[model samples]
Target: MIKERLISLDVFRGVTILFMIIVNNPGSWSFIYPPLKHADWNGCTPADLVFPFFIFIMGTAIPFAMPAKTFDNAAFNKIIVRSLRIFCLGLFLNFFSKIELFSLEGIPLLFGRLAITFGVSYALMGNFSLKVKTYLALSIFGILLFLAFSGIEEYREVRIPGVLQRIGIVYFFVSLLYLKTTQKTQLLTASVLLLVYWGIMALVPVPGIGTANFEINTNLAAWLDNELLPGHLWVYTKTWDPEGILSTIPAIASGISGLLIGQLLNRSLPQLEIIKKMVIGGLTITVLGIVWSTIFPINKSLWTSSYVLYTSGLAILCLTVLYYVIDVANYKRWSTLFLIWGVNPMIVFFFSGIIPKVLRMIEFKNPEITAKTINLQDYFYSSCIAPFFNNPMSASLVFAILNVILWSFILWLFYKNKLIFKV
Candidate 1:
């Protein structure tokens, strides 16, 4: 008999993806309430929990997705190729989102000098030598350097550290960690990583800055992110990029914890028993997370140890619930929406990123604000959609619901055609 796929995992992944899309695509960012509001600097919010929950789900699915037995060279090569493809796709998305290709005004002097130099050396250099490769490379590098030194200019904000990039890196490293390390070793390694990260953030004094506190000026995390990354690359704030190198360590731990759960679930246990264990485990972890938060502060920007535990615990609890509902109870109807979302997460995420830009390109005049125009997305949400609803929260929900329906339809089409695009 053909074995059945894990209904719980699919449902869990689907639910997580749905929340991710909803939380990300709010009706109006400016009008969001406290729950939706990202943790200001060093506190946990519902919004802060969403990304880690998704990452945790990714970890939970790993054991089921990856082969049980050891792999040969060919299998290893396939894994590497897949990982690289995912990573590169994320980078491509990043590149496309930013607009630093070329500026006619910024390079007038360089263009003039280049034209003169090329004119003088036309015969010696020929058409082949006159290729734009050198200019293009120099231009790209120059733009990056200029951006780095410019100190977070509004128009040049690239938001370098992003969800996709982090997901790519975390997925790649965590998978390797799983392959290389023993279960005990992986758990130990995760523990050491969390403690070490905490120590470094707490103790390390940044140059011209104090310890890594929540304060923007004094925090070492901000200092390191700003000093290390190009200034213009910061998405949320120019002073500190959220996806800094240091913060990623804890993020990986979140995934590792998920891997542990995956390992647990992979064992030949009864469905109801597993659900019970998961709920108990999740609750235990969550309690510990809350307790730890007293000391570590549960900061999402920092990706604090407490935050990781808390989010992971919540993720487990969520999985447990879904497992009970979908797998044990055999309730599959509601899950169809989430299944669609889980199946096409990367595509949906990429489209969400690009679609807003496309909408912004098609702007409508704002009669209330002189010389200011609102994008189609904003107009749709604020003018037409939001006004239909009585409250801001309701309107936001409506907007997110609409996106879910739209994306769900798209994914259903993909599913109908048996189109599963990995990586």
Candidate 2:
């Protein structure tokens, strides 16, 4: 198979992951720039674009990663394992949260118990059967369940869905579709799925909530989240999940869009033709999304159909620009910074999340503050960084930039060592 692997893919992925880290690790959520914040309920923001863009990029990589059109038992196992690993990583991230961390008096618990249980179980079950290993895994997760809803009311239930989880799921289904179907089939599937999602969300009346609506918690997606899995919901709003079930239907379409584009490049047409087609195609989808948004609305939280189209169109345009400049025009020096992150995105993403949570876990009593306590990360930000700026937003942004710099240094070291690992 002829594969058209462009360096711009890495640069684009790197750029997305960079913004993801910045937007997610703000020193204070209150001090975030408006562009960094997600849309309150409807509309898209710069922050909102990161996830779908990442998903889109992942779809583009699918053809390059797995060129074979055939699927076997081995393929099934590989997809399942990778998807689960990414999903579990997301769960690990969710398990370590600030609001849910504190148990009684600013003491973080839960994850430690789960980790120890897994370690001890694995150590003892060295010669166990597959069935026995399954049992052992269940026991470890059982501990997590017990700990999640065990104590204080302030500590919310553990979240089941997240950015990475959604990514994993999208990867799994999109990969399957890519292997099983032709380009025409994949495109048709994406279009049909989007239309079906639009219909379900618009026409069908939400049960228990009465009329069909897009209200925060009363929407059909929110109802399914609350009904299907009650306690295992996002902490932000217990009633609805941003990466909820129904929204994933449209989310799949976003990934398929990338899959189609990836195949488009595989044809290896002339450079001008590729650029011309991409611009026209991107604009067409974008205009459709805008027109559709008049009725259905382009909601980031809901992961609306229009959202899938809008984001996917922009992603195509963004990749086209990068492809032309970096690949066609031979501009390479400027994108070296992005390549560091692009080379080790999975590790960077995992550790970037882990570092913040680990820092939050290590708390020290504030010498000056009387009534409350602060985590190590927050304390450092407040005392060292926040002191310099009058605007809290600037201070928070600096802290975020520091996170980027710290990770960049780490990624640079990993790149220097060539220690890249994939799940």
Candidate 3:
């Protein structure tokens, strides 16, 4: 197998991750530049492209990561374990700062408790029979069931579908799809999903809203969140989520587009010819997406079909530029900064959030005449960044840029140490 790592793809992923860190950790939300902020309801913005671009990178990287055309039992088991690990990591991050770290209110927790208890009890019992272990496990499970249902709400108010969770979910399905089907089939599947989502949004009659519409709160996606998700919407919105369930369908389509591109690159073609074809394909898809938006309206929150195409096309366009510059032209001088970020994308992203959250949680006496307390993050932003810029928006932008620069250095250290975390 002629396997080679694509420097262009790494740079692309690094750039996307960098932008993600910047937009997510603005110095002040209210003072953000318009381009950095997400589109309100029914449009696409640079901020909105980050997530889909990462998804597209995931899909594109899979073919390179797993070069096999078939899945055996061992491969399938590995896939399952990897998916679970990624999903569990996301769940761990979700509960990292939650009020309830562990509660015996769910069956999963109950079973987990039972297993631990049974192991301890069985050790004390001195080599218990299989029959005895079974009885003990069952007894513990029974006790857990009663405690689990004692305080039940009809609907869960909080949901934990973070960015990592969405990435994990999309990665699992798309990776499995790549294993099971050909590139032609993947393209067809993406088309079907996009068309189906478009049809659903256009035709489905949302209750109490009369005819279906694509407006912010009145859209079919928002309606589904209200009916199905209810209290489980985004904490900020409390009604709809940007990365809601139905929207994931098109997000997966975005990933599939990357998968198609990845597979295309595997073909034995001239480098210049491949780059030219990619540019042309990306342009065509982008145009189609813009035309489709006339009817569907490309909304980031909805993860509308047209938005997927547009974002995916943009991703491809960006990738082609990187490929042409770095690969075709053999330009490697200035790619190191992004390459460092690319090597440790997951770790940088995780710590980017964790460090900010930790800093925000740590309060100190305000270094001012008045008696006041402020989080370290706010203090640093005000002292280090805000005073320099007359415009608050410029300060906010600088703060975000500083965050990107800070992470680049941190990731550089990890790259030097070879401490990259993949999942």
Candidate 4:
């Protein structure tokens, strides 16, 4: 059996996963400082880099995790299984936000909505049910109808696309590209795609409008996202989407860059040499990113060219540091916590969404207060935990630290049992 272990990569992935949990599960979303906050519109933030870095790490691991040689039927099958499993897990996460599987209100409303919409649309069109074909048509029509008729209300918020959905779509396309093109060709393709996106965003004037200023409302990216993926699917801004279709172009490039790095690492270069190369490459890309920001600002929402380079460079630099300390120096002691996190990232992310919602649903009444009820999550954070901390920030940090510990223990159990839940 080929021993499938890249200590450095594992450490890098684990670190990124840990940060993702912290930034995502803040004790109070409202109380986060500027670094934790997502970019308002076109600028980059630390939080904004987290998701892309994770995706980049995913790409980096493909070489090790995937079959070593030819893309045979078995290899293809593995990819299909892994991709579908992750995609379903993401959809399930979304489902958890909607309904408790056993509760009265926990009906699979998303599926029900699709079923009803497709059934009606097909019945009206007098077409035989064609499974996914019918559902796809109906889903598109339903989204368009919602955009046209539904006002900007809470009900319509359900229609928007999301980060996981974007990841699914981008993964699908990038995998196809990987299969069709050579490694060098894929790199070229990524470069061209980024350049093309930059050109379109900068030069192509919106129809019936002429202005150089690319403000949130007036920019072509926002207009296209609104026109194509309208309604509540817009992320940060109602008029714009952070994971819009156009922005995904550079996001794929980010993944491709990771794949290239993966290819380099696969070549059996010296560990120290690899670290040196990574440092040099990362610093060069970072400098280019800074220079590019002069013209096209490093905007995370847009997934701007500069932002992609900057984040990719930083991600590589981080991986290099992890590589040096963990693999080269043989420092295995400190990596245990991150190893637990890396081994079960998907499970942790899924449960993070589920646990908070389940806790919030269960209410506890205080004896001293006149029937004052607190959400279970709040009770855990504010009552038992907050007293130990001096201030709100400290309390928040404690909550996040506890969350990490709780989830890390759960992951440790799986790791101890040698249970690797792929996809």
Give me the candidate number with maximum lDDT: 2
Worst 10 residues of 2 by lDDT: 117-126
TM-score of each: 0.82, 0.88, 0.85, 0.81
Give me the candidate number with maximum TM-score.
2
**Can you rank all candidates by TM-score, best first?**
2, 3, 1, 4
Among all windows of 10 consecutive residues in model 1, the one with the lowest summed lDDT is 121-130
Candidate 4 at 378: error in angstroms? 2.2
Pairs in clash, predicted candidate 4 = 160-233
After the best TM-score superposition of candidate 3, give how far the Cα of residue 122 lies from its true spot, in angstroms: 29
- The local distance difference test score of model 1 is 0.70
- Global lDDT of each model? 0.70, 0.81, 0.77, 0.69
In model 3, where is the ten-residue run with the lowest total lDDT?
A: 117-126
TM-score between model 4 and native: 0.81
Identify the runs in model 4 with alpha carbons over 4 angstroms from their true place: 1-3, 72-81, 100-156, 207-213, 232-236, 364-373
Residues 337-390, model 1: lDDT tens digits: 678667667666655765665566566678669699877788788777987877
In candidate 4 the C-alpha lDDT for residue 289 amounts to 85
Ordering by lDDT: 2, 3, 1, 4
